[model samples]
Target: MSLNTIDIVVFIAYVLGLIGVAIYVSREKAGHEKDANDYFLAGNSLPWWAVGASLIAANISAEQIIGMSGSGFKIGLAIASYEWMAAITLMIIGKYCLPIFLEKKIYTMPQFLEQRFDSRVRVTMAVFWLGVYVLVNLTAILWLGALAINTITGVDLMAGMIFLGLFSVAYSLYGGLKAVAFTDIIQVVLLIFGGLFLSYTALDLIGQGNGIVAGFAALTDQAPEKFDMILAKDHPHYIDLPGLSVLVGGMWIMNLSYWGFNQYIIQRTLAAKSLEEGQKGIAFAAFLKLLMPVIVVLPGIAAVILLPELERADQAYPQLMNLMPVGLKGLVFAALVAAIVSSLASMTNSIATIFTMDLYKSDAKPRSEQHYVTVGRIVSFSALVIAMLVAKPLLGQFDQAFQYIQEFTGFFTPGIVVLFISGMFWKKTTANAGLAAAIGSFVLSIVFKYAWPTLPFMDRVGIVFLSCLAIAVVVSLFENKVQDNAVDLDGVSFKTTAGFNVSTVAVIAILIAFYSAWW
Candidate 1:
């Protein structure tokens, strides 16, 4: 696609502005000697609003916006279960999960495991997280970002991949989490605006033939099959086993692991000024989650209704951009770029944190702040290059990049979730049990993913999590619980009960809404 003059101009100007944000943030971090906490956790000084915005931006990347909408086009609204299911997951984390981490003042999820179990468990979990962090999450994100940029700019995928990889790496390495958060606020705003504009234009196109409500009504009536949540065995439009399983079993595992234990998303919470801020920031993110269907998913349905015969699902989102007027196209294009960059910065910074804290200095006494920060930058750049290499192969397999990432997530997350949740409040969970649970669940999930192709994905995840929990519990009962001389739970408490109240409402509301919407 040849971008006109206005599109070219808007794209360049937006890239420049983000580069400027990166430069300013890098200077801020450079001014101080960044301690371990300062570099990894943003010095624990972020305000509630910035944390909230960063959380949303970090979580909603080009993959979710662009790739998820592509899923919507293929699978209809059932694809939206991922977003809605996350509301409940966030509430759980904000209540049961966040306070424990906050009170402990831990830098990474693995650090919590170490305190709750043993250093061996911590190190093992760290290796698991690092592998997923680099190979699955970061790689898929970079690939899709490059895909979106390539679609808009007429550049080759490799070239687009390299450009974005370098640009995000430069700032993320220099400034640490502080830079990521500040720039994320800007990225979120642009992404929302861009989505709104694209949705409006798509609606307008539908309006040209029929009024807004009528257009949607007409589309809905014409292909009721598209809106059906259940798949028939024979029909392409049917929500087959893969589709249904993803909704039922797959989403829960992904959301819980991601919100509860993943370092990147949870890092925003760690940066909050207080536990209250963190809880509130999470609530804000939940509210935003409700809007995702409007911004990303609904347009995809509309695209399918309008352009049903398109050869590929990945083409749906970019094709929607083409429907906009020239100037509006430029603006929407810029917004997509912002979403890509925001996600890149978050991942790059988080990868650096994991490497520096968990692996590089795992046993060493705390190093000087400057030394850690300098090392963080180098790690970020290295990760970016790795992601670029992975992008090409990933994009080739899945019609939409989002599903490709989710499929791989099944391999690691279920076990990690089982290990962390059990380890956190379950005192009887010994370090050996924690390790066994994680490794065992991972093995079970891999078995389901590859060995048993006939089984549904969600069934596999449920089985893996259950198997791990059972093993961990049984092993802990038989073996002596590894007692850490320094193990203490008091360090991780959030004295106020604000999260409980909010979480109660969120859980009930999500349950009612989820069942009611489909029922």
Candidate 2:
């Protein structure tokens, strides 16, 4: 995949333009180096559009671009459950979850735990999240991004990793979440356009240049099996996707933990100007999520039909990129890079936010807001450096990067979800119960992974979630209830503006139509 002069210019211009936009938007006003609020939560002033765009930008990283595409290549449209399910999850979160989070005025997920449970639960979960964000989330994005860049440009993988790390750190370290969120607007736009361009061109090639409709028709006619949204038990890929469980089982656990509870993801909505603004932004993201498979997943299915002999599934996306002519190739490549860098920036900012707010500020006592912001920058730099060093080695072990991420992250999500749900809704859930559920879920996940190896990971997640919920309930029964510490139940409304309601209904209708067509 060699680049001509036009391609080189387009890619270089796109990179420089992205950096310039991030720097420009994130620039400090005179006499106002960001305080904790400004740096961490964008001064709690993100408009609905920025919130929606940043949410998608942060969520769709190299993981979706490279990894989900790889999964699509290997297992077909079943991989799209992650994206589609997330739409429904985001809707539920916006309606039911965001109002509580806004009313509480919490900055991070760990902070919410502390408010509802205790500092012990908060600190334990905080440390665990820090490790996962730095080690697993950050590393996977860098590793997979570098691999894609290496495939596209023939750059050394290590060099690509360092380049991406430095690029993400350069802007995000100074501007923090404000810069990350605002820059993500452009990132999301490029990612959507670039991804669509790639998918469209690939489909065009399949149609022998007839048109997208003809290409789609040829695609279905030739590779009908690749379009299955549900897999049978005997299917080779069943262990990963597992049919109806995707709709009714552990996939929901994953989506809830991710869209509802994950810090980097939810942090965007947390920055919204008001509860209404946040809800609308989330609803907007839900609409975009429905379109994601066209940009992210369909290309891989197209790849299978177009380039069937590729040795590695991960190579599906980049190999498809090789089919593009000069300028479009660079635009698509820029979109890929945008996806990677934006996610890296989002994760780095999140790692810093969690560390500075949940850990450093808690331990250091009240400092100047500026002081904590500085600490955030330091943590961001340190985490990025560590991720750059660790990413290459970790990714080498996985045959399917996306599944490896899901299965490994699955280990802790069930427990985290149980803790959050119990603490939020159940007044009887004691702090000890929350802590015990957290620890017990991890132990049970380990047992499922090692001792019960034949269990599907999704099923394992469901089992662990149910078992941990039971454990928390039993433990809470043994402890005295503290109703004062429970999440406030007053004035919690699922109501939204008419526009948002109509949009939500439209999204659900579209989803139903899709499943009917695809199933």
Candidate 3:
């Protein structure tokens, strides 16, 4: 819980190194200032590795690292279905979805909606995302991250939040997504290695001086109940996991909305050097997905054996950090901070991208690309400031801010998935139908929540998604009019390279083996 000189040195070094890299990677060429594309989309020139690393860095944060570890402590590996299922979801999106987005040369998800539906749909979704990202996503990341740091190091909560906000801005504000995407490579490396090492330390504690393999055996032996990949109907946490629904139902809806349609997460893929490069990057992310539970989940499971009666499950990771030896404690702490700020930077960048590109550019007078890029930087800073200011007011009262935020977001995920999926694939899908799906998804979700209170959340999501699809279909059928804005896939290729194909097989095979062994 205490950081000695060694830990302080390591942490400071990480901060300086990350900032230097961000500045170096985002430097302007002589006589050429950064344009909108360069700032927002990283000049559309990211290699497969940077794109892949940034996506994972953007997705995994304090919420996943700390909250999921808590879930591991409480619910065992069942909590990891979200991570594991996302692996396949990434592959599916890479194969079928990224092509559509990349081919359109869009800057944000809302832009794609404008192309296929209308400006109204685009504006509506843009406003919705901006609200959620600022009030919910950004706030939760900041609050939870600060809380994690405070727990481990006794730092004041407000100071921790301020440091995170400033650090995120320091490395990312000036350079925009280019800074975020490139610096994220360092963040991802630290988080992955630090997380895996922490898991090893915790497992080794359980092994009582035995090696990692023996530690693994001890975990399965001592806390066998936690290892179940699928929960039973009577399991206390079944409501959260919902047995098979995770595999066949609403979990897919959740993953698609996040991995395929969400702005911040998809922005990485959108920045790829080419369609093929992006798809390859996505495949790489899928492989990384398979390893997340080890980095994020295993430590909490180890806690069941290490500190079995902790007051709260959420304390699993922070308290477990007490076990990290002094020399490496700073390194692991840097890893934790890496995920936090990388996610913070990614969210702020996306918020600015959506506001500046989708809303600001549309309404503001035409100007040079530098003008918009400047606006983006200002917006990014403003969003971070607002989030830091309001984070406590918004999230302070919640015991499980992470879960509450997730549940609140789920109210609309089905509708979003339906609107995008129908608009993209159904040629006759009308604008009115898009509105119907988008709006109906939320209203029906509320009705279902109160009327069928006991329905598993995953099941509710799947049911609402199907209902939205049906409503969209009925509305479109009622109009029975020809449409011209359906997605044009003739120009996009679905073929995968030999490397991608082989990687896909390897990822799936690994997932299958993992679940089967733990099942």
Model 2, 393-500: lDDT tens digits are 788878689899999899999889989888888899988888888888889999988998878899899999999999999999988666688876776776788988
What RMSD, rounded to one decimal, does every model reach? Answer: 2.8, 1.2, 1.2
TM-score of each: 0.92, 0.98, 0.98
TM-score of 1: 0.92
Worst 10 residues of 3 by lDDT: 398-407
* lDDT for each residue of candidate 1 in 1-519, tens digit (9 for 90 to 100): 767898778877887887788668646434556677767787898887788899889888778887888888887776776777787778778877888888788888877777777678777877877777787777777777776767666678888778777767655666778878888888888888989878766765766656567766665766565565444456453322245554566567778998889898999999899988888888777777777776887788888766788777876787788777787788888788777777888988888887787778734577767887788888888887887787667566778677667766766677788788777767777777778887887678777767887665656776787788899889888896555533355666545465657655866687567656553
Clashing pairs in 3: none
Model 1 CA deviation exceeding 4 Å by range: 25-31, 209-211, 229-250, 362-366, 482-511
The stretch of ten residues in a row with the least summed lDDT in candidate 2 is: 359-368
Off by over 4 Å in 3: none
The Cα error of candidate 1 at residue 41, in Å, is: 1.5
* CA lDDT for candidate 2: 0.89
How high is the CA lDDT of each candidate model?
0.75, 0.89, 0.89
